[model samples]
Target: MFIGRQHELIALQRMYDSKRFEMMVIYGRRRVGKTALIDHFLDGKTALYFTARQQNSRLILQSFAMAIAAYFNQPEVDFRSWDNAIDYLVSQARRHAGDKLVIVLDEFPYAAEAEPSLPSILQIAIDHGLKDTNTMLILSGSNQGFMESKVLGVHSPLYGRRTGQIKLQPFDCFDAARFVEHCTAEDAVRYYATFGGTPYYLAQLDPQLSYEQNVAMLCFDQAGLLYEEPMMMLREELKSPAIYDSILQAVSNGCNTPKIIADHIGLEPTSVSFYLKTLEELRLIERSIPFGEKPTSRKSRIHIKDPFFAYWYRFVAPNVTLIETGSGVEIARKTAESAVFATYVGQQFETMCMQWIFRAFRSGKLPLMPVLTGKWWGNNPLKREETDIDVVAAEPDEKKILLGECKWRNTVNETEMIASLRDRIGLIRGYRETTLAFFTKNPVHETTLAKYRNDPDMIFVCADDMFRER
Candidate 1:
């Protein structure tokens, strides 16, 4: 079930084998697989794993004690308080002499919120107690703000104490594809664009169903997991869930300007700005001005950073009434009717292909080093100010650009797509060393395949190639 993250796994193993006290902090948005990764890596190891709750420290201590008793086969072990519980945990870790004891505190932010002094206490234990006891401590959470402030920030008591940290992210295109029971990389990209790389979301998908069908079941159905997921997620993470929902809807509808969103939600811009900052910190929303620019740039646009939230707000939440009253088939029909969704997902699909292009180029699977890669939007290539390449890769020094056109269709003729790529490049202002590459969900035309005939610069990649044909 573990796919990709070979690098992270290796790094984690190396840290564990360092023969000293170690601390790892892993945090990310909900369902990004932080806990899963830890669980997967430490499956059979001697580890004390506990999820923090919103209760008082005393209650949390009791829960931890219970877990320890269960794990150690001593149901009657008594711990009077949080401090005692932690002391015992450190003692047990020291007694386990072979390998280091792995202790994971999932949702540590919740515990810190419940007890402000928890971090100081943890720092004491890590510094005075566990330093030479061979313990690997992991603190993971979904509340990025709380985690940063209490544990990872410079002013925090626990800052600079962690040996390793991972901001667990969603699976990239290639990794997500591996979760597909039976689907092509093209299908996986579509899935990733909509549900995002969240393991929980991808795991819920039915491989036998098409993307639309899966959406119908999971989003349109009133009892589905995602039917009210946004609401639940916000309520869990923010104090003002309704206001946050309004702001999120505004962003999803393209009201990226601060004034526009505030006006739409009937809130003051300053107040809305506070919520926006929180969203940005949590990685739920992002402010972007094209790609490279200052954070306060005038053209900056606020957008939902997570694809699933974007898709839900744009498609499912907007049409909630219809979905609530309509049949499943009607919902699916309506979803399919939106061709614009394809264009949206197509752009993301194209980006994923670009990543593979860069990876292949880096690995020498393809010829040439692509120095610059991005989509040219307002800077159109055509004279009529229409038609831009879906993806472009260039070697600025060589004055060479590789033009690519992505087709998510069932079948693609490489020659025709490449021909279109050639035409699209005409609008690029500074074009130098030009190469041709095609990324298609469907197989390329046979004649075009024959024409390339092992050409280095002229290359084609299908959905299968993106996932290493696994």
Candidate 2:
């Protein structure tokens, strides 16, 4: 079943119904459901959908020719080249006489990879034939860099030909949780944290199976579906998977700074930066700075953006030899041991809280909207010390700042925590209004709750409220 992507569906359908010549480009990482989304839109329409494979140009052309024949309800037509394939579609569109004919060219970069001149051919088709008719050509690819630089960049022949583009990102925690069946909100959160909102990973989780069983089945055994996923993920988009894996593993294991990652990976900082930039473009990692810091700030740090990668690198990657040697049970047991996984989950829980807070601000559920939300950590000039705030939302023009803290601890001195947050708020100067918010995985302390019970400007969010409402 389709779990999410309502927004993308609506936008695509609106364009489909516009009754104009349109060329849409859709790109994302693999298994993000670009094909599925297109399928959903093409269900009731007269469409020709061809998925290009990792085959030679001749074979790809043959497959597309077969689709063209099937669409026109005629015998298979022999296509000479990619130019012929695209021109055949353009001819069909022109013959349709203003009636809408949707054409989906999935895995377009693969086709281009097989044939270097495919994009130029597409450009010609769009300019002379397809654009003049009521043809809706949707080019979709998993090669993000290729699609962006080769097809969408200004110097490319296909530049300015796309009517619109959809860069489909993975689902967020709340949206991803919808895919699980009969799971409680907390369990769903764990599921999202482990799968990192990828539909391909989430689909493998059985509703009947316990979480431990699913983790064991998917991640522990040598022959498990996700056991070798770390390499599999990088192999698709990168030349050498080992280096990227090492860098990602380093970040997962707390080597966040570029210098630290360089030291761990035995690469120089400049070399590490190139690798980090590639990973960042792939959306596998995050580089965060203080809320309003410029790009050159020394306070920047890298983080593993994908929860599954973090879990894999921290737990599975390091334990690969043991698992490969048929120690599945031992690996699972070791993974379940101690508070390490809990600490990781606590970090992911804070990220989800910030996401929820940003959503609330966007939907007018908050007291004031913010221009951007980020974590703040720098020298506190007023306090003459260093201070780190978990989450901060800034509205510079309005002089309003939202200071937030997340606690995943089972017990806490809530009064002192709030007091510390108040002090941090004082450190943040130039904001006329400041809102201090606290999020916790456990229940809010009764004393702290009673104190802020009457304060609207103060926000106290507990796990129960977040899970129940988000």
Candidate 3:
């Protein structure tokens, strides 16, 4: 069942290929496949795998002793301290026939939190016990904050000790498509919008279920896995989960600007800024500006980085009480009737188009192009309003710009769509070398597609083309 972790497996092989003492730190949000990657890498190797618990130091030490004993087929080796247990492990690793042993400490942050001195202890073992032995030490954790502050931070005793670090991210749209075989391009895009590419969420989806049915089971079922998973996740990560939830809810509900979010949540802008920065650092939320500006000189807005959390805060959290007091099916029916999923999917579709546009530029699709990019508008002169362009390619020095539109509708009228693209090009200010791209739910018009079939300037990229290797 392992899919789409080619890079991580290759990295593990490289570490062993060195044949030196290796210390690796791997961390990411829960359900992002860190454990799965480690398990996949250690499939046939002589490895010791142990998960740390949130408990007292003595209890954790006992559990580690038991894990070590189990790893070596010794069921009853009693060790008083981690020092002794790791000493025995190093000895066992050296005695084994393999050139190197992989030792994985999954959720190492929890263990370090339970025993504040565990990292120093591991450092002791690494320096004195395992440096000469053929062993690779892998430490993994879910708490980005704790991992950074306690183990990886400069102030930590074991700082400057790790040889490598890996942050496991969700798979992109293509890898996710493998989970549901029969979905169309549009269906796959919608599924990614709702569930994201998190492996855990994709695994929960039933291939036989329709999109709406899967959403009902995921967010509205009484005993579903994801019904209250967000609450549990924040409770474990934050000191005050309620405040964190409030901040996320405000951002997810279209309160993006710092001042706007502060006003909506009734918190001072300064305090909200700190929380937003922490959330951004944790990769739970993001701060973005208009696409083409310098990182420092644009209006910043907050967004929930994880799609599942965004969906939960937008729909499920707002209606949790009704879902609890009334029937789950009734609430889900009302939620689906609101067309929220459609809007979310539309945004994801736009994102996919933009990614492909940038990719095409990188591959020399556009001749002498400075960048393939996007622009957001606080005020539009033609519409006399504000909006964002989904994709924008501009050569600022040449005063040239290209505008594009993305449509996730069931069907698109190609003649009308091309006319609209023509109109959009006319609205640009510093305009030159105008071009258009259309990302459609279905294919483009026959004559229109044939017209641009050989043109390099005007392009139509399908969703599958977005992730293709070429």
lDDT of 2 by residue, 170-265 (tens): 888877777775677667667777778788888888888877788889999877888888689799889878899889988887898999999998
Question: Between 1 and 3, whose TM-score is larger?
Answer: 3
What is candidate 1's local distance difference test score? Answer: 0.78
Note each model's CA RMSD in angstroms: 3.4, 1.8, 3.6
Task: Name the best candidate (by lDDT).
Answer: 2
Give the candidate order by descending TM-score. Answer: 2, 3, 1
Error of 3 at 470 (Å): 14
If candidate 2 were superposed on the true structure by all CA atoms, what would the RMSD be? 1.8
The collision pairs in model 1 are 381-427, 399-432, 399-433, 400-433
Candidate 3's displacement at residue 336, Å, is 3.8
Q: Candidate 3, residues 220-263: lDDT per residue as tens digits? A: 87587889988888887878888888899998889988889889
- Kindly indicate the candidate among 2 and 3 with the higher TM-score: 2
Steric collisions counted per model: 4, 0, 0
Best by TM-score: 2
Stretches of candidate 3 exceeding 4 Å from the true structure: 91-97, 355-375, 378-387, 392-404, 411-436, 464-470
